[model samples]
Target: MNRIEKKLQSLQEKKEKAFITYITAGLPDMDHCAKLIRAQEEAGLDILELGIPFSDPAADGPVIQDASYRSILKGTNLRKCFELVDGVRKDGCELPIVFMMYYNTVLHYGLEAFAEKCAKVGVDGLIIPDLPLEEQQPLKDALAKQNATILIQLVAPVSGKRIPEILKDAKGFVYCVSSMGVTGQGASFHKEVISYLKSVKEQAQIPVMMGFGIRTAADVAPMKDIIDGAIVGSHFINLMEENQYDLDVAKAYIQTFKTELK
Candidate 1:
């Protein structure tokens, strides 16, 4: 099994929920991004979703969009992201890293070449929010050849019917969007979120991780039984921005969510 699948199985055996943390690469700067990743690993995150900043990130909220813009301004591109990962690996950080990006970035890089680079750079998986299931086969084939998994997203309620098909094609873990809209914090968790997770879990053989709008530990506390993992992006990005490269604060915030899973 790949890193993500193994992580899910380990969590299942331990009767624990996985804590997945998301952060934009080169947010404040590349050095800070590396530091933040290490901090997350030290904080006990099971998975790290490294956002590859794109010029136009349609699936992201204002916070992540702004972070991407800042990262671009600071010279964080696909190639630089690979370099960042290389630096992390050179430093001996072996935690699983998933490249979270938009489809346009992949298209610009050429799918086959991108897959080769990802494999060489040690990326564990890919999460392209804009890539539809129908159009993913070629990229999937390329990544499969290199032993990398593709993580697909399932938006809530409206797309629940497509869960079985999505799961069929999904190799890593299924990212379940916690709300109807884009990535951001919501006032509260909807009752329908749990129902949607139940529907997907019934049909999904792989692990299911919920993201989008989950900001606090309390938001994650109730989800322990319904899903395999929880992904926090906007909130964690917000914390990183506020902390301004102080990885300790980021680690503490992430650890708070990790505490909730227990």
Candidate 2:
């Protein structure tokens, strides 16, 4: 099993929820980005999602969109993102790293080459939120050639009927979007969203995780029984922004989330 599957398996053994967090790669700059990346892993992240900054981030909220804008200004490209991953791996950080990027970047970089570079650099998976399940087969096939990076799929509320189809080639886990909106911590899962999540859990053989709008541990406390865990992004981004990108403060913030999870 890859790092992601292994980490989920370990969490399952401990009867604990998995924590997956994201940081836009090369946010302020590569140096500051590396610090936050390591800090998230140290904060007990089961999976670290590094957002590959894009000019047009269609699915991200203002927070992530702003971060991507800054990263773009710093000239963060696909190769540079890989370098960050390589640096983390060489430093002996075993935390699974998932590249949360958009489909346009993949197509621009060439799918096969992108997957090969990810495997060579020790990346564990990919989370392309904009890619539809019907169009994922080509990307999946490319990643399969390397047999290293896994494709993580997102299933929204309206996609309940297609759960089986979405999870058909899913790997790492199923990123069950809690809200249909872009992505922010302020978003909440209503009764209908929860009911939909429960239904998703019923069909997902792999770990079913909730993302988009889930900001705090309290938000996920009631969801443990219905979903595997929650994937947090905007919350941490807001924290880092509030703390002026202080890695220690953000690291401490993550521990607080974990404490609340308990």
Candidate 3:
């Protein structure tokens, strides 16, 4: 099994929920970005969703969009992202790293080449928010050859009946989108959202993680029984931005979620 699967299995064995979070790769420059990654890992993050800064981050809200724009302005491209991962791997960072990027980034990078690089740098999984389930095959096929990185599936509240079909061949974990809109904070999951997640959990063979709008420990509390974990992005980015990109402040904030999840 890859790092993603192994990490999830380990967490399950420990009876602990996964504490996943995100960071825009190369944000505030690569050196600081790598340090923040290490800090988060040390602070008890179970999975690292390393976002590749894209010009049009359609799936993200303003916080992530602003972070992506700043990272892009700093020349953080796909190649640099790969370099960042490689650098961390060399430094012995064993956190399960998943790449969250747009389809255009994969398409332009060439699917086979992209998968090959992921294998080389030890990326455990991928999440392309904008890519439809049907169109995931070519990339899935390419990833199959590497046998290391999983093409993580996403199921939304709006997915209705299609949730089962989308997660049929899922691996790593299923990222269940908590709300209809873009990724941000102050997201509340009502009865319908919880019901939708229940349907997804029933349908999914892999562990299901709730993403989008998750910000605090309180947000994760109600979801404890419903999901295997929570994925926080915009909130984490906002922490860094609000603290002037302080790694220690970011680490302390993540520790709160980790404690809550445990």
Candidate 4:
């Protein structure tokens, strides 16, 4: 098993769900991004969904869109992201990092090139939000050859009857979106939604971690036993944005956020 598989296995043994955090690479700069990546593991981040900014991110909401813009302004690119991952690994952090990006970035970077670099740079998983399953076979085959980076897919309720087929080949935990809309903090966790998620978890062979629109600790309460974990992006990015001038504050907030998982 790769780092992520080992992590989920370990979490299952401890009866604890994974606490995944998302941050856009080079939000302020790669150096700052690197520091936060290291700090996240220290603050109990089980998985890191590191974003690679694209010129246009259709699935991203205003917060992440602004974050991508900031990262791009600071010169973030796929190459820089790989370099940052290399540095993070060298810094002795093995925090099951996954790249959450759009398919346009992959196409521009070349699918095989991206896969090869992910294997070399120690990325445990790759999530291309815009890549359709019908178009994923070639990319999936390429990643399979790379042998390290797992292709993580995002699923919403609208995926409908094909959920099982979509997850059959998933290696790492599947990312289940919390709502139908784009990433944000206003998503509801009502009983009906919780029931739907529990049903999805029942069908998934791999751990199902929900993301997008999931905002706070209270939001995690209802997902117990049903989801293996919760994935937070826009909420996380917003926290960092609020603390941008002082990373120390941002880092402390991350530690506090981890406490909410229980």
Each model's TM-score, in the order given?
Answer: 0.95, 0.96, 0.97, 0.94
Which candidate has the highest TM-score of all?
A: 3
lDDT of each: 0.81, 0.85, 0.89, 0.83
Tens-digit lDDT track of model 1 for 4-81? 777778888998888888898997888877887888888888999999998889988899999899889988888899
| Candidate 2 local distance difference test against the native | 0.85
User: Which candidate number has the best lDDT?
Assistant: 3
lDDT per residue, candidate 2, 37-147, as tens digits?
888888887888899999989999999999999888989998899999899889888999999999999999998899899899899988888888778889889988999
RMSD of each: 1.5, 1.3, 1.1, 1.6
Model 4 residue 237 distance off true place after TM-score fit, in angstroms: 1.3
What is the TM-score ranking, best to worst?
A: 3, 2, 1, 4
For model 1, the superposed segments whose C-alpha errors exceed 4 Å read 153-155, 187-191
Worst 10 residues of 2 by lDDT: 185-194
lDDT of 3 by residue, 1-262 (tens): 9989999999989988898998999888899989988988898889999999999999998999999999899989999899999999999999999999999999999999999999999899999999999899999999999898999989888888788788788899999988877889467554588788888888888899999888887886776888999999998888787888897897888888888777
Collision pairs in model 3: none
Deviation (Å) of 215 in candidate 2: 2.0
Error of 3 at 118 (Å): 0.5
2 or 4, greater by TM-score: 2
User: Residue 256 in candidate 4 has what lDDT?
Assistant: 64
Q: Least lDDT summed over 10 consecutive residues: which range in candidate 1?
A: 148-157
